[model samples]
Each structure stands twice: as C-alpha cells, then as structure tokens.
Target: MTHLFDPLTLRGVTFRNRIGVAPMCQYSAAEDARPTEWHLAHLLQRSLGGAGLVCVEATGVLPEGRITPTCLGLWNDAQESSHARLAQAIARGGAVPGIQLAHAGRKASRRPTWQRGPAEPGWEIVGPSAAAFGDYATPHALTPEEIEALPKAFADSARRAVRAGYGFVELHGAHGYLLHQFLSPLSNMRNDAWGGDFAGRSRLVLDTSDAIRAVIPDQMPLFVRLSHTDWVAGGWDTEETVALSRLLKAKGVDLISVTSGGLDHRQKIDLVPLYQVPGAEAVRQGAEIPVAAVGLITTPEEAQAVVAEGRADMVLLARAVLRNPYWPAQAAIALGRPEALVPPQYDRGWNDWGKLPVELAVAEPMPAL
Candidate 1:
C-alpha cells in the first residue's frame, strides 16, 4: 500500500512523496499575464516548505482567457522565459515544478476575489455558446473558425510550457472553466454539433488534449483536472466523467485529478472531509489509472487512510498548505517518523521537541509556524 510519505513516479519524473501542492491561483501576475516576482517567491517558498511536487496556478493561453488581471500566461516567448525562471527557483527548493494551462471561458476577466465585487466586468468572455456563468458574465458564442483556433492556443501554450522547464502539465478542464462549460449541459446551451450529446459535448476537451500532447515531449507527464459531477440536474454526471476518463487515458493522459461542483453559481455542495474521495476512487477504478484526491483533507491520518485503502493514489493540498506550508514536515511527525524533507535550516529545531508527544506537536504548534 502507498502511504502518505511514499514516492510516486510518473513518466520520467519521480516525486519524493505523495503530497503535492494544488495549483491555487495567486492573482499576483502582471496585467498582460506575465509572471511577477511575487509568483516566483510564493512557489519557491512552498517547495522549500517540503512538498514533493509544486503545481503553479491556472495560467491562461490567451489574454482573454485570464481569470484576473494578475494571472500567469504562456502564450508568448517573454512569458515562457519568465516561467522558466520561476521553474528554476522551484527546482532550487528541491521540488518538481508543474503548470496548469487554463481557459476560463465565461468566467474570465473578473476582478480578483479580494476586490469583492458582484457584477461582471466589461471584457468579452467567450465560450462554446453565448451563455453566462451563472450571471457572472455574458459570453460571446464562437463560430466554427473561432472554435478551431482555441485548440491552437492550447498547443502553443503547451510548446511554451516545455520550453519553460515544467516537469508536468495539467489541463484545467474542471470548475466550470472553458472546457467544463462545454462539458456541462446546464452551462452549454448550444444546439449545434458542439452540443446535445455526450460525445459532441466532449469534443473540445479531447481535441484540446490531443493538440497539447502533440507539442509536449513524451517524457513529461500530462494530467487533467476533471469535474466528476456537475452536482445539478440535467447536467454533466459521473457516468459521462467515467467515459471521458477512459477516453483521456487512451489519449495518453497519465492521471486524473478529480474535483467536483463548480458548473453553476448557485451550487449547493456538501463540503465534507474526503467528500471528493469517492469521485477519485470512481475514476481510478473506472479509468484504471492514478487519481489525486483533494477537498477538506486536513489530517495526515485521514490522508494516509485514503491512500492505504486504495481510495486514491495521491493527495493534493491547497488551503491546507496555505494555512501551513510545513504541513508535510508536520505530517511525518504525526505518523511517528521524521525524515529529511525538512530543510537543513530547521534541523537544529528538530531536537527542540524534547519529551513532547508527537500528537501534541501536531496539534499545538504547527499552524502557528
């Protein structure tokens, strides 16, 4: 059984442990989608904090695909070089660097979440149809020509990502983004060939993944984040997701990162610990490939149980790591072991736990650090 601290190898990349940092958008990029100094520092800190793998945020393939003014981009050479610098910094901290290429569709061009606004901005959000993302924005419908151009954008970004030294690439196909918008019937109301059937609705994601794989090297691992269920009636469901996962596996994807319930603004989800674990298990069993589970997984014992019982191949942490960048280091102690994933700077303090129980160390002084 694979434990939380076990190593995992995919393609030519080997992770030191199964714990990975989820790609959470920093919203600290330049207006033109270039990576700033803040982006480099944030990722480097997490890597140093002891994650086996660090995935950067959802980066846009085009200017209009950005979620906010400060999202990263890989559509140009300058952006590619900037990302390469970020990758170098992450490597220096002893973690494998990864990137998530994304297109927000109707969810694009919004003010950062820190601004706390309710209305959509003036930018034109484009999607498969002229539908809004639950009153978020009015998207412009794409013609056949425009729809064909979107895959080229994805391929161009993938080529740049290889040049940027990313060890892995994840296609952002979940959370009601551009590809998810096409997948969910509730959001995609197009009656053309791009809609009205499972296979037709899935065309964009399949074609986009194919185009991306064409540009990236076979040695680099490729994955996709999928919304297993839309959590709404008459919307995309688990059956469709299972079918899609098998198809994606045939398209040469290595794993599926299972996430759920972002297809609508009025989504009523049951956010419980390991609520998404079953989805990951479903994909793992149905697709017969590795799957990463995320969502309210805060404890080491719980994460260990999930992996040990064959529920998931790995665990992804976003907000948990934000609350404690050293969560992995603490997790080792929680499981009654301490190893060298900790930086040498913290080695002296490792002995300071004198006579305290491991549970006390995990409960009392972890998040405060």
Candidate 2:
C-alpha cells in the first residue's frame, strides 16, 4: 500500500507526498489581478507545513471572467510577473506550485463571499444563457463569437502560468464555472453546436485543453477539475464525467480532480468523509485515467486507503489543510514514518509524535476566520 507521504510521479513532475492543497480562493488581489501579500503568505505557509503540491486559486483568463473584482488575473505580463514571485516562494518551501485557470461564466460579477450585498457595482456577468443563477443577479448570454474567443483566452493564461514557473496547471471546469456552464444541461440551454448533446457540451473544455497543451511544454502536467455530479436530476452526472475524463486524458490531462455539485440552486450535499471518492474511482475505472479524490478527506489512513484501493491516484484537501497545514507532516508520525513528509527545517519538531494522543496532534484551531 502506498502511504500518503509516498512520492507520486506523473509525466516529469514528482509530488513529494500525495497530499495537495485544493485551490481555495482568497479574494484579495488587486483590481488588475496582481498577487497581494495575502496570496504569498497563505500559499507559502502550506508549503512550509508539508503539502506536496500547492495550487493557487481560480485565476481568470480575461478581466470580464472574474468572479470578483479582487480575483487574480493572468491576462497581462504584470500579473504573470507578480504571481511568479508566489510560485518561486512556494517552490522554495519544497512544494510544486500550480495555478488553476478559470472563467466564472454566469457566476461572474459577484461580490467576494465575505461581502454580503447585491452584486458588485458596474460589473458584467456572462453565462451560457440569460438565466438567473439565484434570486441574486441576472446573467447575459454569450454570443457565438464570444464563445470562440474564450478558448484563446484560456490558452493565453496557461502560457502565462508556465512562464510564471508553475509546474502544473488545472483548468477550472467545475463548480458551475464557464467550462462547467457549457457542460451542464440545466445551465446551458444552447441549441447550437456548443450544447444539446454530450459531445457538443464537452467540446469547449476539450478544445481549451488542447489549446493549452499546445503552448505548455510536455514536462509540465495539466489537470482538469470536474464536478462529477451536478447533484440535481437530469444534470451533469457521473456517467458524463467519466466520458469527459476519457477526452481530457487524450488531450494530455494528467489527472482528474473529482468534485461534485454547484450546478443547481437546490443541491443537498451529504457532508461526510470520502463522500466524493467514488466519483474519482468511477472516472479512474471507466475512463482509464488517473484521479484525485477530494471532499472531507481528513486522515492519513483514509487517504492511504483511497490510493491503496485504486480509487484515486491522489488525495486533495481544501478545508482539511486549512484546519492544519501540517497535517501531512503529522500524518507521517501516525503512520510510523516520521522522516518522510517532515522536512529538515521541522526535524526538531518531530518528537515521538507517534506515541502522542491522536487528538492532540490534530487539535489546532481553524485557520480561516
């Protein structure tokens, strides 16, 4: 059985541990999308705490695609340069730096989650149709020309991420975002070639991946995050994600990070340990592609079991890492292999933790306020 701290390689990239920090957004960037001090501190701390791969949050390809005015952007040289510092910082702390390229689609033009209000002032929200996401705001439909231009924007951002020293890039196709809006039947009411059937719906993401892969060198890996199930009836489901995984695999996607929901307003999620692992397993089995299982995966033994059982190739954590960035290092002690995930900087801190109570090792307060 491969332990969570074991090194896993894909293409030319090697992750020191199977543990990865899922892209969690910090809506603190400048209006022009430059990385603030907050971005550097948040990601660099995770690396120091022993995460193998640290993925920066959803960075928009174009200004209009931003979910918030303060979201990161890679559309220009200055923005790329600013993020390069962050990438270097993460690498210096012994973690592979990655960026998730995204376009919010109809979910654009919103205030950051911290801000409670009507939509941000003077921002345009775009989606596949003129549908209202919730009772919050109205979204404008995209024209055919705009749809054609979107892929080029994504490719452009991928190039910038590579230039910024990202070892890997994940195209954000999950969470009812732009690429996802095109894939889900409930959101995409288009009768044209971009919708109606599964092939047409998946075309946008596949073509975007192909364009991005063309620019990025083969040494750098690319992954796609898929909402494996929309959690609503007659919407994007497990079967569709399996097929999408096959297409993404052919387009040079190294892994599929399986997440679910965010397409419907009425979704009832079952919050439990390893709840989303099955989706990753299905994609891995049905599509013959590697998968990264996410959602409430909090323990080393549980993460190890997911990999050992062939359910997923990697285990991604968002809230779990936020709860304890040093979870990977602590996990090493729990599994009786303290030398693996522990860096030389933290060697002194590794005192017979294996003998300590499990509750004491993981009883830290939440990082997020």
Residue range 1-369, candidate 2, lDDT tens digits: 767778889899999888899999888998688999899989988987777899999999998788888889999999989998899888876789999999998887777788854454747778888877777577788888988988899999999999999999999999999899999999888988898899988989998999999999998899999999989889999999999899899889999999998877887788889999999999999999888999989888898899878899889989988889888777766776664444554444554544432222222232352
Clashes of each: 0, 0
Top-scoring candidate (lDDT): 2
Per-residue lDDT over 96-213 for candidate 1, one digit per residue giving the tens place of the 0 to 100 score: 9999999998888887788844325447789988878766767899888888888899989988988888889999999999999999989878788778789889999999999988
Regions of model 2 farther than 4 Å from truth: 343-369
TM-score of 2: 0.93
Candidate 2: residue 160 lDDT (0-100): 91
Off by over 4 Å in 1: 118-122, 355-369
Tell how far residue 26 is off in model 1, in angstroms.
Answer: 1.0
Q: What lDDT does the true structure give each of the candidates?
A: 0.85, 0.86
For residue 353, model 1's alpha carbon misses the true position, in angstroms, by 3.3
